[model samples]
Target: MKLRRRAGLFAILAAIILAIAYGFMPKPLPVETAEVKRKYMRVAIEEEGRTRIIDRFIISAPVAGFARRIELDAGDPVSKGEAITELEPLRSNVLDPRSRAEAKARVAAAEASLRAVKENVHAAKASAEFAKKELDRLRQLFKDALVAQEKLDEAETETRRTAAALRSSEFAVEVARHKKAAALTALKYSAAREPEEYAERVIIKAPVSGRVLRINHKSEGVVNRGQPLIEIGDPQALEVEADLLSADAVRISPGTPVLFERWGGDKLLKGRVRVVEPAGFTKISALGVEEQRVLVISDIVSPPGMWAELGDGYRVEASFILWENDNVLQIPASALFRYGDGWAVFVFSNERARMRKVQIGYRNGLSAQILSGLAAGDKVITHPDSSIKEGARVRLRKERTL
Candidate 1:
């Protein structure tokens, strides 16, 4: 009986100690996991952009007058040289005698001014020609070491100045002719003894074959000279304009492939970068952050009919493909965590969480390319937290398996 009691007590004591040890031991951690995949991967930049006509034209009134009601509405198609609007003489309830005299005097003054401008244009042309020749001669002399750099620079500067002056003089000639025409029209209208109904109407025609984008004035009203009347452009010649961060803009160059989506179409549009403007502009983002942005123009390489539903100012999401590969070993970006000086992931090995340091190549918002320390079909824990550590026992929910 004594031996039986001792054996029974020892067995009970062993049971209690075993239960205590088991209770203090770390429990299995339930975790979500995903398999490392070997698949195609791409690193890209996404930004919202607007569609615009590549060659937009804004037609304006040539002279101040009473504009007749525009018969066209926005989106109305017209051919080149089609009359889209008319301009009639400004309705005048009274004609002043002094105004008539002033009109005649203005015509004479305008003629004198036009002649002087013509003479100036001729002088500017001669000066420009001389500057070009001087620049060419100085360039040759510079190459032979016969002229100093300063002299060469001065000659080049003078050439540019003369060219600019020549252009300005030519533009001035157009302005002077317009003024002369205005003065003559004023004189002719002032000579009318009664209301200016005798004045002829001027027809405004479409400068290009395109659909009207918008009308500045749909109803008849008084208009100023050079006031924009209508905007016109071909809807078929559409390009996307995206303002990208200057930092991102530098990474992309002309001919970069792009994919456009969410543009209210079932078709995925393909395009290529055409130009990255040399200049940058400041824009405030929706988060109130000031960002320096550059305008990136992209050409729609897809058939125009695919994006026929798209129009000016339409919004599109542009994905610029910076890097891509067909066969890449990648894992979810969330599976990675900072470990020491490098990045690491929790690999599920034999029902235990194993710390793995990995060399990563390119990472975007979702996936990361694994350059080393991992292989295909490896399962990695996602959203790892404090509960996970080296050699810790882990459980894979039934939905996930290695």
Candidate 2:
């Protein structure tokens, strides 16, 4: 009985030791993982932009005038030379006595002065010619001693005085003629038809064919010179103006491919970089942080059928294609981790998370190109568990939907 009792105790003790050892064994950590994928990911720089007209104009008043009539409203389509607005002159009635009588009186005064100057000029010319003939005759008689020296001197002096008087009279006539001409010009100006009388108003014509985008003058009143009247643009000539950080702008150049998304449209519009502005401006972002930004203009190359709903000034999201890869090994950017100043990925080995050192190449926001240390169909731990170590056992959970 003693021997049998000792054997039973030994078996119970062995069972207890085995149970304790099993409890202390390393447990497999549950981790979420995904198979490393290879996709054609384009490296891009994203930015905010707005649709703009390729040609835009802001019409302004060329002269100060009252807005007597407005023939078109905002959004109206206008053709070149088409009248858009009109301004009437301050005075409209030319038949009124106050205007007609004043003009007639001025005309009569100009005619009278002109007639008087003509008669005076004719008389002065005749008198000057007669004086010259008399002086010539006296000089001949004095040379032949047929006339007294004092008499000849007196004749010459009289001739000279007559010539001076004629010249003075001629000058007076010329002055009168100039005065009459001035009066006549003034009268013509007074009798001229006012702008309203001719066109009934000053017509504001469209300088170019376009759709009016905005009308700054809302009421019929005076609009000062240079004051904005309306904004016009060609809807068909649409482009995008994107604002990018200075650092990103430097990498962009003309002819680079671009992808554009409208504010609410699901379709992506393809475009090409047209211009990268050389200038930069400082702007305060929504977060109240000041940043230097540059404008990049791109031309939408996608057929209008794709972006028919887009309009000028509409907001959009643009991605500038900086680089691209095809049929290459790539993984989620989050799958990468820092391994002693180099890049590494958590890969599955023997159903456990293993830290595999890797060499990385070009990458974008969502994915990184694997230059080395990874292969297709490899399971990579995207959301690694904290309890999982390099050699620890792991249980892989299904990937969650993005």
Candidate 3:
């Protein structure tokens, strides 16, 4: 009986020790996981874009004058050749002392030039009269058989040449007079003498039939020639401009499909790449990073009434399709980790973590293409950490969904 009790006690002590050892062993790590699956996958580049009129026109003041108050606002319909605004000559622009002096000198020079031209005209006229008389005399001599026909022809040619010279001198005088007038106008002397006379209304007309987009001048004011007055464009003819990173733009080509969204409409609009500008510009990102960007122009291919409410400068999101497949083996991008020069994933099998080297093709922010080293229905440990090691025992925190 003593031997039996001793044996039973020893067996109980051994069982207790074994139980303590088992309790001290490291417990399986609990991890969140996802199942790899075959699904439709696509790789695309997305960026914010804006709508713009393809044929925008800016109307500028045709002449420097007093621009009347523009009653027309943006979006106002305008017809081709229809007057949009009137500019009446205001008291000529104020001239500085130096400018006034220069104007006076120019005016005097022009008057002197005009007098010289007038004298030249008189001299040409006198020569022409002398030539005509000589020609008549020669013709009379030729008729009497005293002078040769060649001499008569020479006299007639001289008369014609002198007449042309007189006409040229007269034109020069007119040009000089115009110069004098311009000089006087520049000095503002004409305005000072006949202010009301300079108030003749000059009408400005629309160059094309379209709606006004912008107005630079609204109130009556003086404007210089070539100053912008309004912008006009056909709202129906619209395109989209997207600035993309230079790296992404290189992959885009003309005629690539595009999807436009978040443009204040429930339905998505369609567009196609028209051009990838050959040049790039430097842009500062919101995070203060300098980025090289290229312009990607896209034509709105959707029919009217679909995005009828869309207008110039409206913001939209654009997605440029790069590559896509209807069915592809894909895994969460988070499942991938850098391994050597390639990529790897922590695959879950037999309730343990297995290091896997994977060949990846394309990847976006959310998912990645699995070209090899993984199969459909395989479970991967998402967000793997240092605690996960080769052959490390793992327990699912919850059932992983495909």
Clashes of 3: 0
How do the residues 2-34 of candidate 2 rate in per-residue lDDT, one tens digit apiece? 999999999999999999999999888877776
lDDT of 1 by residue, 1-402 (tens): 999999999999999999999999999999989899888889999999999998999989999988988989899999999998899877753348887788789988888988888898999999999999999999999999999999999999999999999899988889999999998776555434465453588899988899999888889999999999999999899999999999999999999999999999998899999999999999999999999999999999998888889999999999999999989999989899998899999999999999999999999998999999999999999989998999999998743421
Best candidate according to lDDT: 1
Candidate 1 lDDT score at position 87: 91
Query: Candidate 1: deviation at residue 214, Å?
Result: 0.8
Best by TM-score: 1
- For all predicted structures, in order, the TM-scores are 0.73, 0.72, 0.72
Task: Report the C-alpha displacement of residue 24, candidate 1, in angstroms.
Answer: 1.1
Task: Quote the lDDT for 38 in model 2.
Answer: 75
- Give one clash count per candidate, in the order shown: 0, 0, 0
Candidate 1, superposed: residue stretches over 4 Å from native? 93-196, 398-402
Clashing pairs in 3: none
**Residue 315 local lDDT, model 1:** 99
- Which 10-residue window in model 1 sums to the lowest lDDT? 189-198
